[model samples]
Target: MSLPLAPGLAGTRILLGISAGIAAYKSAHLARLLKKSGFEVRVVMTEGAQAFITPLTLQALTGEPVRTSLLDPEAEAGMGHIELAKWADVILIAPATADLMARLAHGHADDLLTTLCLATEARCLMAPAMNQAMWRHPATLANADRLVELGWILLGPDAGDQACGDVGLGRMLEPETILAQLLDELEPARDEALRVMPVHRDLVGRRVVITAGPTREALDPVRYLSNHSSGKMGYALAAACAERGASVTLVSGPVTLSTPPGVERIEVISAAEMLTAVESRMPCDLFIGCAAVADYRAAAISEHKLKKTEDASGLTLELVRNPDIVATIAARPDRPFTVGFAAETQALETHAGSKLERKRLDLVVANDVSREGVGFGGDDNAATLLWRERERTRRHTLPRQPKTALANAIVDHIADRMR
Candidate 1:
């Protein structure tokens, strides 16, 4: 199905930057899609990119001469790079390789594509493509983080099969998906209030507190209990709130994700530590308890690692219930508007609704973690928002999508309810 075009995208100018990767083949289809969608399309090809897809093919699709050189005498006569930079409303680089990301992050204007990226005042979007290992490497992660810090948007390095027979994240998102993300950024939410608002930063002057990641409950000095929460959803929500001008404080548990720009992050490990950290940032305009806190902890922690005796078949330890962070917050006399997340294995809606009533939460975001790609450590999510509204309960289901997009949707709902 064709996607709906946003009102703000009328007469939009797009400069498509293709980097070298096996995913470069997808760029041809991307260029055609952009042109067919009524965007004024232009193409820029890296030298290595020419080996995968010829400039002539892209030129044919875009109806514009593909530019590949930083030193083209004819084009440079008019300072072509500067002109191209000014003409675009957005620069979209598909198959943005790890090397290209590193160069861009470090301000390397050594090639035509990089040079134009440096010169452009336009918003930049990158869809990274590489091997799974490379994508997960610390260096690449740091580079990607730095680029985001510099106001660049990353679409996806979606998880799945790759050209090299490796299966994991590092596949560039499909062209349709990338275009949808771009459209979302360019336009307001399809709501009357957001459409008429002068500034899209709806959370301005609001204080938001978020909890994230899996809290570790120590059983011994060397052992702990935790979950597979990667903190992606919570972190995405934090970024969305910050983008809307909220003063956000993220009370995070153990996770390797970087702190979103414009957010204050407090690091903790155990559930108790997380509770203390969250309580200290209380009385905010909104509070989202997104953390996957452990339900139990060792009643008596062993200072030393427990060793299994050969004669004993198994070892047993006493356990105690951990404090329920979200429930406690909702029970507060002066509680802020509270939201909780329910990661369920069955009866998604039923459990979510129960959480809403039982915990006294203003809203509960429910997701089935049993699904393949939409929960737990994955980058995408589909959720149902359950809440009580006067005489009836309301339920809104969000389809499977990148956590970034889903986060924005959740924030929009929250903002609407607040209004």
Candidate 2:
């Protein structure tokens, strides 16, 4: 399914400046992505940026002429640099080199890109990309701090493998991430509302193990049974938990989601595999079985591939119950604060209450997947969080919002209780 876009990103004017770095190649893809996402994208290249990537290539991708020089008299006649700078709502510098960053900090405008950066009232954002050593250098560090102090937004210099074969910090964040940050910049109110939520490092030193996504029950070698779970909620939970200083281990089912930073990820395909994984990460402070593990699996396996019968004979196969991962964990003598998710189509509160009692769960987050944009494969969700402790039952309603925000709220609730 196509992921939803940033609010108000469509038709927003964005000025993208490319700098000298191997990561410049990524900016080509970034330009194409922004344009496709409905941003009015324009490209500016420094002389050094031109060396790494051609102007024509960026021009073709942006569907507009690329600007490169500080002094092109013909273009200067119209003061094109100033015009372009004024046209932008936000100026994004990707693959922003240490040199460029230093120049920006010191108020240098010797180049067209830097000149435009000064000429505009538009918001300025930078994504630093360079060698680990360069990124760590005291000079670069000071420059970065200065930029931040001057109200210039600096995005990630993510740690990963670099082109120079050295490993450490200094990889530019992917285009998708930069785009998300871009949205946050464009819509500060969305971010501000999140900041008011009650969450902190209250889970520090806690160990959190969460299961996410849909478990696949194999019917044949090539086919399986799974749900419409995108694993987004669980992944968001993993991220939120980590952000709260918890040591998070994510036992994830088959899903195309990236591991949250600083979280350990365990990939499993089937329900049985999921149970084993969750059990192995034992004695954690919390165990959240957010995975949509299949209730049953094929009772027998065929040695070879199953094929359709041309004679129209129907085939039947036996099925068996899969292990109850969350219940089993909750029953452990050293059980952590167990949390489970009930993505119900009907009677959400009733089913959630039953699950909480049946599994002896500390909490159950119940959401009506039947409601559009609330659960399953969407970006947002709403839920009724039911709790049971010492025979007392309580529940709180989580308002409809982004899964990230909802996950934060869940984490906040758990953290507040634990504290």
Top TM-score hit: 2
TM-score of each: 0.55, 0.57
Which lDDT tens digits does candidate 2 get at residues 331-368? 99999989999989988888999999999888899999
Question: Which 10-residue span in candidate 1 carries the lowest summed lDDT?
Answer: 191-200
- For model 1, how does the per-residue alpha-carbon lDDT over 193-261 read when each residue is reduced to its tens digit? 433223246665566899999999988888998999999999999988866756678889989998775
Give me the displacement of residue 317 in model 2, in angstroms.
Answer: 1.8
Taking every candidate in turn, the Cα RMSD to the unseen true structure, in Å, is 12.4, 8.9
**Which model scores highest in lDDT?**
1
Give the alpha-carbon lDDT of every model: 0.86, 0.84
